[model samples]
Target: MNNLASQEQIIATAILIVIYMAVVLWLVIRGARKTTNIGEYALGTIGFSPVAVGLALAASMTSAATFIINPGFIALYGFSGFLSFGIVMPIAIYFSLIVITKGFRKYGSSVKALTMAQWIGKMFNSQRYAIFFAFLSLLLITFIVLICVGITQVLSNALNADPFWVLLAVVVFVFGYMMFGGANSLVYTNAIQASIMLVVAIVLLSSGLEYFEGGVDGFIAKLASIDPALVKPTNPDSLLFRDYFEIIFCQLVIGVAIVCQPHIMTKSLLLKKDEDVNKYLVVSIIALTFFFLVVFVGLYVRVYFPDLKVGGQVLPMDSLVSAYVVSKFSVYVSLIVIIGLISAGLSTLEGLIQSISSTITADLLDPLLGKELKLDIDSNQILTNKIVIVLLAAISFGLSYQQLVSPNLSVGIFAQNGVYAYFSAAFVPVIFGTFLKKTSLKAVSIASVTAIVVHFSVYYGKFMPYMKEEVNNPAIAATMAILISVVVGGIIHQLEFSKANNKEALNVH
Candidate 1:
């Protein structure tokens, strides 16, 4: 694979990346000028068009997992991976996004909520609940690690450099800019990144048109020739997509819950006007639909490397997309794809850094140190946020290096485990808080705790049959956790409601 990228190609890619970084830094500086207080830093002071925020949402939602990592799953597991990731998950995500965005934004903007923890805490009127979620937001670091590993793979392959150095460079550069840029810079940078990704998605999807020259059946037959299971909707031999339960049910449940994450759900609050909400949803969903389909490129790469080998060495799933870009495209084309891939990772990385660091500073530290200790936390919060980003960068680099060096199948697994648990715990609280007129704080709190416990117990303890395997599906554990939490929370809410009604009736009599 190293031989596939010429010396000229490497130099061209390196130069393009440098110019790309410069453009991003310029955007950050422009945005930072508007970011004076923690509020502006978190939500941005500038008014952005619905279309731009929509693009930012699309870019953040479709991270490197869409462009770089998940394709590796499709490459390995075949049609089953497409069914689960490409088809099932997107359907659930878009539906959930549309359903939740309106109500969330209405409440978020009204209260001037800055982070998920702040929203949840205000919703429940419980400072402890907010602090709990603040701690849980730390789980998002796993997702940051994922984006770092993905960008590292693309950059390392494009420049023919050591992945360790690439990973280190990616973390420092992206996290450094995010320390000051916050949401102000993130939206503009993400909109630009999303535009590049849109073109690159089309380029990548159409790159293997020759495979479809004989139509859909011919493409299936080509894959079947490689392995009959490649054409099947369910790959029993695979670790993640073994049956309808894993492919359809689990992914469907996880998809709806996935939008509960802070970076995704809070995007609506960026829109200032009620009229903008509908347009934001429409544009983002349409763009994300196309971006999600980019995973189909994995099948093309599968056909390219039938045995999943290049230059007599087996290609790791994470490197499959990078290898394909360099080997299959011209130098110029490869550089475009490389930049798009980096954008995919950076767009999401910026969001995570902004949202998570804000959670630490505003939701976690300010509450604990300021209110609790009567300190002037707000006076130096922006500086504290920058320090939080630095700490996050260090943690992300360490975890990302581990994934790059020794992954269990792919970094996707490690990420899904932590991310799934988070949104799983968040699902009931977010859903009930958004739609229900009245909710029991105790009930929602119990539900959240149940989700965390159930998710890890099923995942680590191997309680479910799906978990009995050597490599478990985080979706399965997450789905079970979600189901149980919903049931528990529902029961508790009803019981409390009935008891309160009885008390009111007695008082009236």
Candidate 2:
């Protein structure tokens, strides 16, 4: 499609983007002042108020995946795709509150635990498992960076600007703020950016009403005229139905993985009190629910510009940000689009970088070099973390560029697939095990390994005859993975206990 942004809109958007970035940078730096040590920098020392933690958790997890890709998926699948918000949000909140209640309270305020791997290591008494989890966390972070880069390019297209330069600019700004302050910086900035994005969403949705020339019910009628199924609760005959359900179910299971997600876990850990968890859960669900509604505005674009094409390719289904902004409002909406996406990308990235750096230093490098290198724990840990942060960002930047420029692969799709795979394989075990007293460490091990094996099977076994043409959905795979983890984890734990009881009896005899 031809560029929708007028010069005036482009200019306004550029100014807004600059201002937004400045605000975010300020939040990052200001928060850093309170961060004298690793704990403060990594998890905010005291846990946040429940409201703040809730918003931060909801915002951090709602990346480009939810904003850009989901609406598009909805366009294809209608209500089925949107149902995930309802299913996953409550489950995630419930799981987090239960798992984190004790863990967060027991850990010292100044302990500076940055990653879930550290916490999990303590719980299971297994460094090997922790390292394995640490790597999976790193992989998820990589995909997150890629999504950031991709969204930058999309925002540029919406603004009629050079995609390469825009992506670079966003990367530099995000990296700088994250490097300076870490997770504290990420949360503070996310709160600010999230607020603005909400306002912008309201503006776009309000403006789109003019095009609808109808009230809410009228608009629904119009939408039905285009595709009746667009408003339905299900897609009955779609080949994708089973797959989509799998995605939603798995998403719910893996959503609990947010508890184990290093970046998000640290945010929860940083809060000031256990009471904050409940407040945060409520606030986060409300805010994210509103945000999801705003994104669905894209489906309305289909009603306005049904045949719009960009580069002879029908605007990709994932082009919700562009389609909604371009078709519903004036090009000035690009300002909101860019700011919202940047907000989403940077908040998550800041947390990811902070957590990853701490993991490498505390878990890997420091243990090896601490005594021999004669480095002091506190000062050297900070220095090592900073260095690792820079290196991780540098590597992620390269991978991001490759995905952006790749011939056929879209960064958004690649990330969604990879994240679901990683979460299913790694986190499903930890979250469930936390609540189930019957769950043994060995059972957790079985679940984790099984998930990894199944995940890899879907990817590599694509060439196998039975698997070929199976059209693997990461969501489906993740759901199956978690189920296996839960069932196997429970069974294994029980069997082990049974064996121990038998041994005790035999010894008495």
Candidate 3:
């Protein structure tokens, strides 16, 4: 209810934040020296170790959603949210990550593909498809907005400052440095961020050990005392997790396909050699598993505020974790967590800004304006990418400010809508290209189109109205999109195979 941070806490926080920024900026400028071209900027010229890249990968994949927003969901809806967010989703994602990363990196490095749109285009041999996806990648701006709001919430609460000023300062600082550092600085910074996250995750998870005085049984009893639904696998009153279908099936589908996003899948391309893949996957999966399970911290927060009230105001889900951190911890502990929280945000925010800007400059603008503008890929393109980042920062700031002012249920929904759709379209091309041979680009293309259509149609149309309210869940749309893409892509792949077989047989005759 009160501004829990003391004057001393605020001063220490500001000092620590400034020191962190200075370190980051120094590292970034050092990396920027080698980035004479767009290629070097996006892919990084640095010969990074697998462990460093692994930590970076973990940081990129988790984002503010895992550390900040989803925990709020668990705090609100109870065990159903935890079962889905903390348990089932991680299993599905880890399995998918291991299965997909090696093949993707191998092919990506072989072709020297620097971004996801470029990879898809190269794999399908369709420049048009690549350009289309480059434009589609703009949808990731929603995710950037989500991170901006999440970080601002934490910083504003900790500093007891106005959210608007915090939001402005965060955007300028993050996006400004990102334009110079690119991927080279990003991996190093992300590794540091991941290390901090690993520590804070342990602290947050352990903070509630006292509540577990009765052990696992006792913890559940505490939740049950407040609301019996809090202990159940499904919370009927909740919007997202109403049944087995929504909780397990939809979450599993989303987890498996979620990595198809550019910032996530392209992380493996940072590693240099083939032999390092196993080590990278091992470290990343292990670290990310802990990060994912940290959503259970929501349970502790819920127990701390059983009524979910502060000063008689029902806390919004986006701000709940920020509120809880300030109220629960002493100044010293809270300062550490605040830095870690900022890291959680910056790691992914950096990835999004870099990948999206590079995709626009390299994949979209280069193709559209290169010949007409008489531009070269070496120096001119790098300048274009910076310009792109500037535009991206402006757009992100506006959207983020809007969400912070009047959110439609939370910025997470606004993000999931756009982010989910982009990845759903990508799943077919990436999956088929990596594993299956003799795949038809036509088939993959059509399947992608189908996926995007099906996803939006399901969400907007409210296709199935069973045990349900309005179709506000993004996972449901994404799940349906993935299933149909796989099924449709398989059918098309078979058709193309037979057609080729017939043509080859005729040629032999």
Clash count per candidate:
0, 16, 0
Global CA lDDT of candidate 2, please?
A: 0.62
Across residues 10-60, which tens digit of lDDT does each residue of candidate 1 receive? 899989989999999999999998888788888998888999999999999
Which residue pairs does candidate 1 place in steric collision? none
Give the number of the best model, judged by lDDT.
1
lDDT of 2 by residue, 188-209 (tens): 6667656765676576556556
CA lDDT of every candidate = 0.92, 0.62, 0.90
TM-scores of all predicted structures: 0.98, 0.86, 0.98
Report the lDDT tens digits of candidate 3 across residue range 357-436. 99998899888898864558477887788889999999999999999988878899889999999999999999999999
Model 3: lowest-lDDT 10 consecutive positions: 463-472
Ranking by TM-score: 1, 3, 2
How much lDDT does candidate 1 score?
0.92
